[model samples]
Target chain A: MPSQAFAPPAFADVLAAAARIAPHAHATPVLRMRSLDALAGCALHFKAEHLQRGGAFKFRGACNAVWSLDPEQAAPGVVTHSSGNHGAALALAAATRGIACHVVVPENAVAAKLAAITAYGATLHRCEANLAAREAACAAVGQRTGATLVHPYADARVIAGQGTAALELLNAGIGLDALVVPVGGGGLGAGTAIAIAGVSPSTRLFLAEPAGAADTAASLARGARVTDIVPETVCDGLRATLGAPNFDILRAAGAEAITVDDAGTLAAMRLLWQRGKQLVEPSSATALAAVLQQRERFAGLRVGIVISGGNVDPHALYEAGALHGARA
Target chain B: MPSQAFAPPAFADVLAAAARIAPHAHATPVLRMRSLDALAGCALHFKAEHLQRGGAFKFRGACNAVWSLDPEQAAPGVVTHSSGNHGAALALAAATRGIACHVVVPENAVAAKLAAITAYGATLHRCEANLAAREAACAAVGQRTGATLVHPYADARVIAGQGTAALELLNAGIGLDALVVPVGGGGLGAGTAIAIAGVSPSTRLFLAEPAGAADTAASLARGARVTDIVPETVCDGLRATLGAPNFDILRAAGAEAITVDDAGTLAAMRLLWQRGKQLVEPSSATALAAVLQQRERFAGLRVGIVISGGNVDPHALYEAGALHGARA
Candidate 1:
């Protein structure tokens, strides 16, 4: 399918995605931490996607995409280019359908993530640490195996599937004033925007982005796609440039952006682990960081923060002394 | 209350305790980890006491003990000697009833645990690392402040309160062939024994103890309480000698012991964090370690493992290189 042919996922797609992925995906719990709420000066409802299958929200989209494929389309299997969580999620999703999975992983990917992708029985193709190289490697694998390519966050099905998390949250009747989600390729943010618009129109959407990889923020600021910067951040999951359709959807939904530095993200991650007892990765922490960084804006509001994933290397984080300080 | 006059907590007490604590304590979720089940070759139901208020199963007992107090008794507040979790739990529980709480903490307790105790508005009294010093300090505090002593595990109210966790697990309707819990002061284990006896008589009970602090196992083997050995394990929460009443209750229940070394506990802790997405402390990991260590005994059986706590210092664990390698 060509990029031009792709349509932006609507709230209806999210509803369908919820029903389609119900059998395979986990309806992760919404956790409330009083300590966290006290710190943020808001009632925070945390959608614990870190506890989802494959230890991330990536599973929802991966499972939806894999199962949505017809028998003939799925016969050749599925392929994707991912630095970590999506690769493992897609591999696990493909495994559920007993189909082959090919993942093009960048050279600089975390070792623990590579181990997980392999553990999930994906055929990994190593590529240079660049989008061009990753895409080329993925295309070559697709050509060879006739596998259908599942773009990490750009695809409509993936965006719709990612929205199910927000749908579930809204369905819980938490009456949130605003929702915050970390934006990488913007699947979760765009999907969440659509879900909030349909189910709770009064709810506002805030996209959390790492300052080092703040293309989404830049895009939102300039009212256009921004894909030129070289990403630099500890959040391995939030390094991708905002995808075109994702940008369009987010812009259309009037989503706001909250950018957090690496220091803020690390501190928030530590707080989540220590106080919340939830082992969310740095990418997941960005959502909390955003809420905390802008406390004045979120004060006394019922805010929802989506913990995007928990596929981190504790050893690596420890080695970096990321867990040493009490900043947040 | 004199030791000679005190009776072991019975099923009736457990029922009463549950009712008393229902308003204060969380009925923690029963989580299922399929990967963990596959690894252990059994259906594993994880009683997530780590997510309990004050980050441990200790809250149930602490809350019950505080609420069970008469208004005049509660007015003077409560006091306890604890290395970690119980202190924080008691402090938090006391805070709920707007009562003063004094915690006698050993010098060598984890810094994070100390922070949690202080965070919960408890007055901390530091003592030497010995059990005798801790008790002396606790008694002195009680004498000076007119506070009621809430023993970590020895008191009937506490034991009954601890039983509520297992009661909730049993109430979840997940029929299990066996249940596992880390044996520290044995409050949780003793309580669990009563719960199992009352709710599911056929369910076997297994106490997961640290080999370096295997007094519970020693007491069971010798058919008497043994409080002589110096504990030398990394599991901060499981270093206590078995309480006398706890021993008596376990002996009556014919509970089995499964001791795990520090290395096994560390490995299992890492696995729980990495795969189970639960950042459990070493004490909590012992239950999973026990299951993994004695796989054959639990194979094909529906097993319940109570994750005791999550008050670990990630910085300390990392500095000690506890999260370095994979051995499980």
Candidate 2:
């Protein structure tokens, strides 16, 4: 079994990654203020990661993780468990590095995402619905094939690489008074806060959570990490509970989180699409929804929002619109 | 009347435009070879102009024309004859420069595009649906406002600026064997062919047109330009026939043009949205449709296609699906 622990990425390590990935990763243009901001009463600078390769920011972490492995350790390939963007990103990144990849996927996972992983030449391992089953399968696969395990968020390299997104934004000469991001397992937010804190001390960090499944907010309020709530938000990317290490990082950074309902998220998504003409996913729309719903707090401040990805299936989009129509 | 007859764009003028608009426009990402290519048996590289500001590549010409005016000729503001992407783009760009703008629009243009122009602080002049009536209304508005007339395509600077898109693609460190672009007024094709020929002399140029309104094809076949086609293509942007000057430029460039039905455009659009994960307008999809439908001609070599815009209304999309469902 090629199960080896990875080292935690320091703030310095993330800065190093900002330099390393600068060429490969898109600076992803920041959209200027428009009518939506006037409605929300905030000066918004949207970092369009939805335009990122593989249709999401996950490609950053996935690419770094694959490229970081030593030749000997990587020879047998890598394994992880994900049902969405992360799976496709890792598969594509592995293909780029000419290494084998194994994705442990839940059966009901989106067909398009699965097609992307397969198209990138990765092997798939189907698992049961339970978390225990997914983890067990990943471990067994890693052991049987001597492939190294790359825990999506729990791994330090992935977190550090994800932080480079924020690093790129700040380095783009933006002096944001507040930074808002969608929080799922807290990898992106935790790493972003660390990056922002190190480079721009004046900036405040915020995490956006879906009200239907706000594990991060509950965890923040309880002064401890929380988990295992039934999440019903349409923002599928942010359904995971905060990872322990990420929670600690967020606590240490003194970041606060805001939650918005499904209605609010979809409305924000529609507004951004219509006014800004930028297509993004529900998870990416969460921060804008938070800002819109809770406007007074963000007024008169330069705010940065991360648009995480745009890989929603066309059918899923029709279904989402059906949900929106029902709400209307 | 502010309709001072502007010189039509010449092949050399487009070459110079390749230099002028280089810094202002995006090289627009190009994606190549995947599942769709496997099915079509030819490589496809999509130049995603839909990612351009104002949600369309029309911004490039509008920006250059608005900005290129001798600070004095540009002072009273600019007038255009569009109720679509060009109207919005010119409005936004003119607003950015702190200049006034006048848009003479047909009463029935898309509301979203209308809102965009109004949002950018451009003065709108509603006109009748009849072409002669619209042109007369545009002239009246331009004359009354003392604004410089910035025709959508017929003008030399506009055509040259539109050509800049293909120029950047050729400059982006890749050597493609052929270039495919959606043809409307033949502005983009005329400009793009000139640009491509100036750089890669061997690269063949082809134009894609919707069969419902294949005015450019009819005009080319008859060895002259014709504008009196009862346009019916769902690709609204492709409704314009080849302008007189544009047809002249195309004839000189030795370019070939083909027309595809709406079904082919939709299939290509779906392929791009699903497999390429890029959102674009139907006119943009026509280029890929040409490649997909005529796979035998482009087998085994590299090809580049431009996706022109991404501003489809959500309601229209729902309506399209509804109409298809009812028919089925």
Best by TM-score: 1
Chain A: TM-score in each model = 0.97, 0.95
- Alpha-carbon deviation at A114 in model 2, angstroms: 4.0
Number of the top DockQ candidate: 1
lDDT of 1 by residue, A1-328 (tens): 1122588888889999999999888889888887889999999999999989999999999998898898988999999999678999999999999999999988887776788898889998999988899889988888888899999999999999999999999889889999999999998988898899889989999999999999999999999998898899999899888999999999999999999999999989988998788888999999999999999999999999999988777766766777677422
Q: Across residues A14-51, which tens digit of lDDT does each residue of candidate 2 receive?
A: 87766666656666767664566679887888887886
Candidate 1 wrongly placed segments (more than 4 Å): A1-4, A107-111, A326-328, B1-4, B106-112, B126-129, B326-328
Model 1 chain B poorest 10 in a row by lDDT? B1-10
Question: Which candidate wins on lDDT?
Answer: 1
B22-43: candidate 1 lDDT, tens digit per residue? 9888788788887888999999
Over B171-276, each residue of candidate 2 has an lDDT whose tens digit, in order, gives 7767888899999987788778778877887889999999988988888888977777888978988888678888888887888888899888987876666556
Model 1 global lDDT (CA atoms, 0 to 1): 0.89
At residue B322, what lDDT does model 1 achieve? Answer: 89
TM-score for the B chain of model 1: 0.96
What's the residue-level lDDT of B316 in candidate 2? 71
Docking class of 2: incorrect
